[model samples]
Target: MLVQKNVPLQGLNSFHIVARAQALAHITSEADVKSLLADPAWASEPKFVLGGGSNIVLTGDVKPLVLKVEVLGRQVVGETAKAVIVEAGAGEDWHAFVAWTLAQGLPGLENMALIPGTVGAAPVQNIGAYGVELQDRFESLDAIDLQTGETFTLNAGQCAFGYRDSVFKHSSSGKQDGGYSPIGLKDRALILRVRFALPKPWKPVLGYADIDKKMAEHCTDQPTAQQLFDWVCEVRHAKLPDPAVIGNAGSFFKNPTVSPEQCTDIIGRDPKVVYYPLPDGSFKLAAGWLIDACGWRGKSVGMAGVYEKQALVLVNRGSVDGPDGATGGEVMTLAKAIQTSVYERFGILLEPEPVVV
Candidate 1:
């Protein structure tokens, strides 16, 4: 375990926001985690677990001790004629894992290529892209109980996955009569490792309309997993700003899902509204369409602005003219504006995907 105090978190998070953590610990093994938990210094203090830091936004300096998970390994644990079971450390980079799987001719995860964040955090949000979700390939995950300092294995069902949510995220502080308790800084449980079952023959799934169109345009009758992965990277690169170049999370808000009646009412106002029918008999509206329709694209407030290329992304355009250049971008306010605009335009609420701090 490596420990530091008063660490700058600006570069750690993808958003490039300047924030500080009172203490930060890098854990490379389960034993290291156990040792840290045994320390009296952290006994009652709040704790925060961070991975690649792609899916989080720090509003201000975080008070808790940030534990950076560094445990790393990838192995093919089991194999059959049709499928293979691969286990990856929770701290492994998600995109790196996807590339590795594709290199090994694994069929799944191609659609999730170029996604930021770590493997451990994938199940927390049930990360998805291009019509594929992590839950579809997830087998199980090993998590450490913060209270008992014991590890527990949770199957897919045990994870209680919903769209962009999981038991780890919803029940980080355990369950309550109303629902899962609110997540507290120190009380959140930690993920250790994840197991995925991927197909062996490596058949690609081309469900997304844009991806399919791209493939067809290229005149490729049978696009390999690598080809598909490359295409996804290109698409994402074109649509989303690279956090390294511009400070922004990939997608700020999830596409809102509403009842059929709600969709009808929304479309009754505008006939060209884009929507996708959900399996639950609901309608999922395009959040970007709504934001763009509201004329927020490329709009800026101080240093914060919506990405011109993709309205779903909010960007930080460097320091604003203020004393000490202290006028930092406000993501919450922009998000709230987008949320209110969507609500007013279509009477549907848009929820942010990134964890707000």
Candidate 2:
């Protein structure tokens, strides 16, 4: 039930934006949350769960009570005919968890190696990379209701996973249409732990261009899970700046999806537009290509700058540990400008991926 006041948050978030939490608390276990809820001091206050802090942008000093998730555990929970159930605490580093899975001989999560953030935060964004997504490996999850303090479990379907989105991203208050809830958990729930169903018969997820290049370079068609993990890490390191060094929140925008006709129109204008056909008969335009096409690479707004190597990444050009770091406002300003340019050029509004606080 201990609460710290005026906690510095620049180190917590990947963007390294200068900010602070008015009050912050750590939840290392479910009992901690229960205890906090029972206290009159915090029971009725609005709360925001902070995990690895890799997927958020702090715009200013956070006014809500920041509950920094620090729960920890990892084990093989059970086994099924087709897969094995593995559980990890919400606060566990996502990349480390992936490595742990591989160390235990699990293969499905290898394709998602090196993705920043915590395991609990993964479902909120339905985090994906290369050719695989969290939904593909998710079995179920246990969460606590912030308002009621009741623990509950939900299966994959309840998550309502979409590209870099899930029920967790929406607010609980939404209009009811066709008997379906539009607003989801949002700030009402705190994910305590996540269970993944790793495949029994291991197989590598291939065909991604960067991965293919690795395969071609190695001259090995049949790659192991460890190899895939190494290559994914290599590819990511090459494209994205380390948040520990140059502050960043990975890809700044979601690759916008459009109708086939819309893709055709864009292609007619610029044949070099990078896109991929979805199984749903839609096309996903590379947001990086659009940003690059608009000539935003290496551009800056204040201390915020677009990565010289990848237009998809927005970086903090100033010192992270000092007073000269980029503010969340500057980051958002740059992001909005890029969005405006991409929309004007390609007739598509690129959505930002990071959660803006």
Candidate 3:
């Protein structure tokens, strides 16, 4: 464990926002977490667990003791008749792991290729793309309790996974009646590793229009896992801004799910509203389309701006390498404006995808 004071965090976050962690500790193993917890100075201090910093917006210098997870390793842990279990340390880069799985002849994670952040963070958001979600492949995960320094593992049901939500994203008041109800571990447990159950005889998850467009352009019907991975990467590169070049947290808002009655009401107002039917009988509205309809594309507030190509993404219009970048407050301001406009015009409030700190 390496602890540093006043650690610069602009480079750590995908948004490239200028901020500092009052105290930051780079934890490379479970031993590091135990060691940190044993320290009297830090044992009771409020703590913040940071993964790849991809899914967070730093509004100001962080006050909590930042535990930056850096544990690393990956391997095929077990294989059954129906599935192959692969385990990876929490710090593994999500996209790199996806690519690695394809190279190793494991093909189930191809649809979610090119996603940013670490494997530990993936479960927190239940990150999904091209009709595949983290929960669809998740087996289990190992995490440590910050309060008691005890380690534990949890299965999918125990995670309480939801759309862009998980038990890891909520906090508990410690008032539960002896069972894991709604009380969550949010910031109370630091994930050490994650395991995925890649199903055998992988079947392609292809329903998105982009994949269909790719199939049409290539004159091929059945693409292999590697082919699908390549296509998803290609599609995402064309649509989303690269964090290394343009600095952004991909997809700033979650697609709002509405009941059939609410969908009918919106469609009545605008005949061209884009929507997709979910398996749960609710319609998922395109948040980007809603923002675009409200004339927010290519707009800005201070140094925060919306991507001209995709309104779902918010970009940093400030310096990429200096202290002068889009402040988190400015980004939130732009997001709030878009949210209010969308709600006023469509009667649906948009929820932000990234955690704001």
lDDT of 3 by residue, 223-268 (tens): 8899899999999999999998777999999999999999999999
Model 2: colliding residue pairs: none
Model 3 steric clash pairs: none
TM-score, per-candidate, Cα-based: 0.92, 0.97, 0.97
> Over the stretch 202-311, how does candidate 1's per-residue lDDT look in tens digits?
67787678788888989986888888889999999989988887877789899888899988987898888889998889999998899998999999766678999999
RMSD to native, candidate 2? 2.3
- Pick the winner on lDDT between candidates 1 and 3: 3
Q: State which candidate, 1 or 2, has the greater lDDT.
A: 2
Q: Per-residue CA lDDT of candidate 2, range 45-95, in tens?
A: 999999988888889999999999999999999999999999999999999
RMSD of 1: 3.5
TM-score of 3: 0.97
Query: lDDT, candidate 2, residue 204?
Result: 84
User: What lDDT score belongs to each candidate, Candidate 1 first?
Assistant: 0.81, 0.91, 0.92
